[model samples]
Target: MAFEKGGENAYDVVIIGAGISGINFGYRLQERNPDLSYIILDGRHEMGGTWSLFQYPGIRSDSDLYTFGFPWRPWTEETSIAGGPLILNYLKESAQMYGIDKKILFHHQVNAANYSSEHKTWSFDVTANKTEKKTFRSKFVLLCTGYYDYHEPLKTVIPGIDDFKGKVIHPQFWPKDLDYANKNVVIVGSGATSVTVVPAMSRTASHVTMLQRSPSYILSTPSEDALERFIRRWFPVYYQHKLIRWKWIAVPFLLVTFCQYFPSLGKKMFRSATEPQLPPTVSYSPNFTPDYNPFEQRVCFCPDADFYRALRSGKASVETGVIEKVTADSVKLTSGKELHPDIIVTATGLKVRVGGGIDVSVDGKPYNVPEKYVWKGVMLQDLPNAAFVIGYVDASWTLGADATAQMICRMLNQMKKEGVDEIIPRLSDKEKNTMKDAPLLRLKSTYVKKGKDVLPKAADRGQWQARSYYWKDYLLAHYGDIKSSIEWNRS
Candidate 1:
């Protein structure tokens, strides 16, 4: 069945967010169930999601493009690490090439979604362009909203930040007219954003100082993959792409595995790789060393060692200390060291907002996500015909998203075969009481810890367990018993 246009606001499937996850799911739907009518609704004016939203200097993918890019549409670029504009273009091109672009409705924000048990359908309250209200209906709803809050970043209260005379900027809302040419800049974080911004801003600014309370694991990787290039030269395009993508996926999986099991060895490996990249003046301890083990928090990656190069050139530097207060002209550290800057960039972390902050209810009763356990890391327990995509923390997000897309498609097909109107993951009261509670996200990062209350709950056993491995999840999605712990209904 083809989707009706004009006044029609109904679909067999409605996917919220035209981001990477939504686009991938749309393709899977077309491939797996061509007769199903579907549409992708995005709140933003553009379709690139994060790539389109973030306009910070030197914005780029921390993960390699080979794995980050869609599985069907391979990233053929020479460079594995890519800039924002390049990635945005790739997404747009892939969407257009696959006819996914035509299936999207931009500027349509889904505010609330309610499931009607009697009707076996979902009704969405939507706001168009921040004003016009509309309603849409679907048999199945997929939230591909990603994890973070788009409107607000994670709040960090810097002591007396109001006293700072210089311009304070957050990377999320970078201004186009803001100029920092030959100006002193201080970036207040040691994460990926800060690492990226320091190097890029150093090119034009008089000086850039990355101020961090503590250091994070930072590794430098080659911009281009020589092995991929060699494979491209010898193999057919199909095999070449497959080989390259698998290589990227397998290597990261192995690395994350090693880090998780042999944390000491992983720390050693990271320290060895990072120590050589630092300048003579900077010591490995305090400045480069992290208190936690590698992958405990995500390891920051610097392509072609751009960050190190900036530091070596004396254009940028790293400072490790606690902020005491901010004076009119400078930031006062507890150690008595003061930094005077014309611009302060708060490259702090992101705020997690699951389901895009959409109010979800079933039969007019509000559903609390954090209280509910996730079934198969895709669907929530007791939620009928609904799923949300939360990607892998250890590997590429697309890998997990693809796994989810395939799994959801399988469920939809099964429903058709069984002649069921609705499918829900359910647990008996005894089983729910006996199951142990676990966190949905495995990371111990500050943002993850802070946003624990906003995320879905998990259990330690069976289908209730949170996502751990891509291959394991992939196998489960394909061949695992879909009937396990699930209930089917006809309305």
Candidate 2:
């Protein structure tokens, strides 16, 4: 099971970061084109990506399992929103079922990739377990590294944080032995992570307080889908799964579209759904209300309204204020209030690293990653025989991953048929000038806003643009003409 270092590796394709996106892409590539030789590499010694990295208590999918699960895999669990351990197990099961685990090289961290125009191959410099360095060569390089930095969690600099005496933690690097039972815990930030951890920690923590600068719109759903359960009882398993998957997928798409086009109406409906869950003393206007419209930022999902129940039962509370300073025993707020806590969980945000923080060059020149436009939402502009799988922000991450796989497989198969060695996506001069500039990711989440500039750009329209809608992306990936945006060359 141990992947040893010191050998020079070569393959038809080299996939970096064997996470959800990487595993899905590798599985599809191997399934579609059996003749192609590929290897999946990860810095971590496991197959599951985010699922493996995150170990915070009560950590579950922000989205439902039906949509979050891979298209090829049927999520047979009764709960639609599964915890981290279950998700990790599902990913591992997927790897074993598709034989992707055998093709994966664990502890292989990609440092840089250099593409040669004349040789038509990518050369990689990789480090294994931070000790041994080795070279790898492949006809193409596929990056499936998720956006967040795995080596270090994004830590925010709070004034006087060094003076704090309490145990501080980031959800990304939750300690295995740190116990919080019967302790006062103050969780910073109002994102999905904060909401999730608040309800979970309140169960044992003497008091859990969620401190936020601004509120994220929170919604709740049943952990297990009753309709899905009913369908499973009456229908064939495969048919039921497919039906539930498509239904869940479509509902999100419709919700996103509705919010996008009708912001006011969407906001009103969101507040209505949230109001009944709040305690009588708590107002939904300021703390629970968001200034941004729905889908601009992702709506936080609290399964079965446990977060609300926790708040109502006085186990946890929410505070909206900026942190002025952190003292030895408490955190001072701008509103002239101080919070005393035994523990502080700074779920501030994630630090986004484009292309897995790996340097990329083309023919001895540094590749300008942020300057390139997305080609059909998957491949970067002017990048030859390379693609990076980034999933949907609006839907499940795997939805975009699956679409990217389908598109890449089609492109690869076409190149094989035409005897082409390189395929590069190019934006015409007119296309570049005519197109309007937009952020690489449409979501206005805190983590995204902080790291948007370093990421790639997207055009206003056409095949070169990026979209979060799964149905549209799925159709384009399967049926869109590859010749329109890319130039195929034999050299």
Candidate 3:
């Protein structure tokens, strides 16, 4: 269906962000509800969201591309793990192929959204090109802005960092022209970004050190999938994609389930797998071993054991301790040890921001996002004609986003058929008071803990709970009660 440009100020749906979730939702919205007029609004000049923003060395997806790719479009690349450029190309291709790119309005940032109870419409205060002000109205709003703050990263106070004479960098905004060749580099943090940068920078730097306050669970996997290749060669082309995608999905799901259920055994399994990859000098306990169980925080995947190989090559090393202070040219550890480096890279983590930091109001009154609840992990409690997408932490993020798109599409269709103008996830004051609050993200990571108050409240059960499993969410989206806890109106 060709989308003719409708009115400049109004639409049936307004999808904020032209990133992975927005693109997926756009495709699903078109395929499922072609009659609805919608437009995608992105603050950035381009698509691909995180993939487009981060240009750090060795930037790649920790999850395999098979599951990370869209369900309608399969990832047929030889390597399961993909770099940033390749993934960006795939997203652009997918958007263009499905005509999603045409519906996107770049340089349009939504600063505030106000929902009217009488009209049952959302009026968005948008800034175009960071200057011109505009208003766009829509019956429904989809917040595909993702979970993190794009402009600012999580700030960690490194003692005496300001006094460091060497070049300091954050992985979030890597300088394009910065050179580290033949220079000693120290990466602060042991997250996915740090692990990726260590191996990637080690190839050019004279020496790369991974400085961490504590250890994290890191596992290695094959970059190329021989089994997937074998299946593709033998199976029919029609079933090949589904098989490969499910294979990737099920494997991770089972592994995470095992880890959650049997943490001790899971720890043992990870330790056994990692012990052989480590250099003889580096012990598994002090560097590779995490105090928490596997999957408690995300498990960093080192494709083809590139990280371990870098360590074995003597170009990269890990240091586990607290930083006492930072000198002009060296970092002092609390263990009374010091190391000199030419550069320091902060790979701490991201700061979580819900609804792309847009100020949301209802009927001219401010909406407290943190005080409200999330219904079915898609729509917010007491918010009419709106939904948001947040992906899975344990598995591929696309899976959860796709499920949310499907559910929202189904709800919109139902509302249309029933002649309802507005649909809100309603909960009584008593129920809200009695329900136990739960964290939306079930990770023990520092970023998740610090940004808890920014997100919406969640319950332990019922439609108010935050569901993570893709399969279960898919089932619920397709067949579960769409009217549960929902209030409908014809305004």
Per-model RMSD to reference: 1.8, 3.1, 2.0
lDDT string, candidate 1, 266-323, tens digits: 9889888988888987778899888888887888899999999999999999999999
| lDDT of every model, 2 decimals | 0.90, 0.86, 0.92
Residues 276-395, candidate 2: write the lDDT tens digits.
998886778678888889988878898899999999989899888899999999999999999999999999988988788898999979999888899888899888889987787778
- 1-491 in candidate 3: lDDT tens per residue? 11223677789999999999999999999999999999999999999999999999999998999989999988978788899999999999999999999999999999999998877789999999999999999989999999999999999999999999999999999999999999999999999999899999999999999999998888898976788779878999988889888899899999999999999999999989999998987778789878899998999999999999999999999999999999998999999999899999999999999999999999999998998889999999888889999999899899999999999999888887888888999997677678898889889999999999898988987789987798899998999888878898774
Say which candidate scores most in lDDT. 3
lDDT of 3 at 435: 82
Instruction: Return the TM-score for each candidate structure.
Output: 0.97, 0.96, 0.98
Model 3 clash pairs? none
Kindly give the stretch of ten consecutive residues in candidate 1 with the minimal lDDT sum. Answer: 1-10
For candidate 3, the lDDT comes to 0.92
Tally clashes: model 2. Answer: 0
Better-scoring candidate (lDDT), 1 or 2: 1
What lDDT score goes with residue 152 in model 1? 96
Query: Each model's number of backbone clashes?
Result: 0, 0, 0
